[model samples]
Target: MKRNNWLSLLEGKYRVEIISLCVIIVIWGLLADFVVKELYKLPGPISVFYAFYKVREVIPLDIAVSLLHFSMGLAAGAVVGITIGGLMGWFRVIDRAIDPLIEIVRAIPPIAWIPFAIMWLKLTHYSAGFIVFLGAVFPILVNTYAGFRGVDKVYIDAAKVLGCDKGKDLIKYVAIPHSIPYTAAGTRIAIGIGWMCVVAAEMLGASNAGLGYRLWSRFYLLHMMDRLVAYMIIIGLIALIMDRIFRYFVEGKILKWKKGTVAV
Candidate 1:
């Protein structure tokens, strides 16, 4: 009975994802082994797995370095973005005064700032973190601003009627709660962008010890295509894990109230 129950639970919860992953692996293996005759162009699953095992010892250090860069940049960007965005949304005058400058800055691509970051901080962890921060901040700022602005006037009025007319009270009780979904969405986007930026920054010599550094070293210097593919797969797996962790904590637990509104 216990085994049956566990099997049913897996079928209900993870069936689609499991099937999709299997299909993707099968297709990838078939194409790499048969269709793509050029082994260097696309290594088969077996080659990639062998490479993974070969580099298993160094994986932890690379993962740690990359995670440190990602976490530092993401935390800083979230705090600054959310604060500025919240204030701008709450105050029309502030928004008007700051919007033009923000728009001008946002027009520049995050990667474009790499030169400036290198000049300012040199090719160090801080430079990499700065690049990741640039990648993460804008999406969070825009989404947070939009979320706060979209808060209904009716809710504000209700708060006022309940003697919560103070700005802080209204924002704390009404605006913040209403904007949680938007913030969560922004955070999700920020994480993806930040991860990409970390890799890019590392590739550009922002760090000497990271997954990106190893990936570039394997591809360019060592000419190890199989190990390069292994690094790429590891990066993807790390991102997937981070995304799932965020969703489980933020969406699944904090936003439990939203469950009733959607059909599972």
Candidate 2:
């Protein structure tokens, strides 16, 4: 009975994803080993694995630096974005006064700020964080604004009737709770943009050491295609892991009530 249950669990939960991943790996290995003999373009999985093992000593440091950059920027952006966005949504006058400036700044892509960041911050970890901040802030700000604005008028009225007449009280008890889902969605989008910005910022020499810097060094300085591919894979894996973690915390834990609202 236990063996049957284990088989059922594997088949129901893990079988498709495991099989698909294996198939992709097999196809990639085959193409790189036989069809694509051009080592400069695409190295085989074996070569990449070997390169990964060879560079294992430096990989942890690079990953740590990149994560630091990402974390700092994400925290800063979320704090400022949510505060300002909530205020703007609550106060029509504030929204009108700042809307034009927000739109103007948001129009510019985060990559375009790389030169300015380097100039202002002088090629440090802070510069990389700044770039990530630019990438992440807008999505969070916009979504927060939408979330606050979407709060039901009836809720506000009910709160006021219950002696929660102060704007702060109403917002604290009602607006924030209703906006949790929207805030989560915005945070997810910001995380993806922030990850891309971290790579771009590191590539542009915002930091002395990072996965992006190592990727560039392998490709340009050492001409190690296998190592370059290894770094690329590492970046993708890190991003995937971050997204999964964020979803698990926000959607699975904090927003458990949402589970009954949607059917999978």
Best by lDDT: 2
Q: In candidate 2, how many clashes are counted?
A: 0
The whole-model lDDT of each prediction reads: 0.86, 0.87
Question: The CA-based lDDT of model 1 is what?
Answer: 0.86
Compute the lDDT of residue 125 as modeled in candidate 2: 88
lDDT of 1 by residue, 109-205 (tens): 8888888888899867888899889889888898889889999999999999999968999999999988877877888899999999999888877
Give me the runs in candidate 2 sitting further than 4 Å from their true place. Answer: 1-12, 260-264
* lDDT (tens digit, per residue) of candidate 2 on 1-264: 457864675577678887787789889999998898888878988899999998999999999999999999999999988988888888899999999999999999998998899899997889999989999988888888988999888998899999998888988998888777777788889999999999988887887778887788556477899988889999999999998888877777888988622112
TM-score of 1: 0.89
Q: Cα-based RMSD of the predictions, in order?
A: 3.4, 3.0
Candidate No. with top TM-score: 2
* Native-referenced Cα lDDT, model 2: 0.87
